[model samples]
Target: MLDKDATEFDGACHCGAVRFHVRLSEGLHSARRCTCSLCRMRGAVAVTARLGDLHMLAGQEMLTLYQFNTGTAKHYFCSRCGIYTHHQRRSDPSQYGVNTACLEGVSPFDFEDVPVTDGVNHPSDGNGQKGDGIIGVLRFQSVGC
Candidate 1:
């Protein structure tokens, strides 16, 4: 949930062809993963952003869109580098699930653990329980520095 004190971040695609600015809905605490078919294959950690919070800075034409299943979620990636940048969430059309990796100085590995949503049985698909929707958590244990 973005408050008046929300901090803005600059982000770009791996190839630097696409750039954007965003204000997360809950800072980095919003980090999460999904268990849907597409999400499972992409394996990206996402943070929430309201539709009005994401502002494309440059190379909008270099971005590609991909959709599947219900096609309600609009996934955007950099065409030059094949990097997933963000997606309009299917369960919540008013928000986008921004790729944490796209943010400058950020990496998915930076999170020690992330909540995994039950996207496989999404509530929008008329299955599973409403609210939270968390099915599990993913933890990363580093061996050495």
Candidate 2:
């Protein structure tokens, strides 16, 4: 459901060790903060796109993947600089959630009406188990980028 006229945005890490381009619709330019344990600790703002819409223009070798808890979601970062760039969310593995802060020439959007999803109580492995015993809790805050 993306507009045909969506533009490509340039982005990089704080230390310039990583860089990439993301094509996104204007409607999706806003940042999203998820209440997940690792996301809260890293202060990540997710700007999502379908897997086909994202491309890593550079720094592929510098990226490292981190997974914990249920180990379904993979958080990618710059190994040399420790800058989180994107992640594969457990809720939807088909989409890549890029960190909005890493995108250049964009500002954080006001999330007054954005719904906060609860991942803390997610069913383990899509099974009927009460819990898998891996608890990951998170909360988010936004500021000017």
How close is every model to the real structure, measured as TM-score? 0.93, 0.72
Could you list the CA RMSD of all candidates, in the order they appear?
3.1, 6.2
Model 2, 23-48: lDDT tens per residue?
A: 76444534466656786688665777
lDDT of 1 by residue, 105-127 (tens): 78888888899999999998888
TM-score for model 2?
A: 0.72
Please report how far candidate 2 places residue 43 from its true position, in Å: 1.5
Worst 10-residue lDDT window for candidate 1 reads 1-10
Clashing pairs in 1: 1-25
Worst 10 residues of 2 by lDDT: 131-140
Candidate 2 pairs with clashing backbones: 36-138, 37-137
Best model number under TM-score: 1
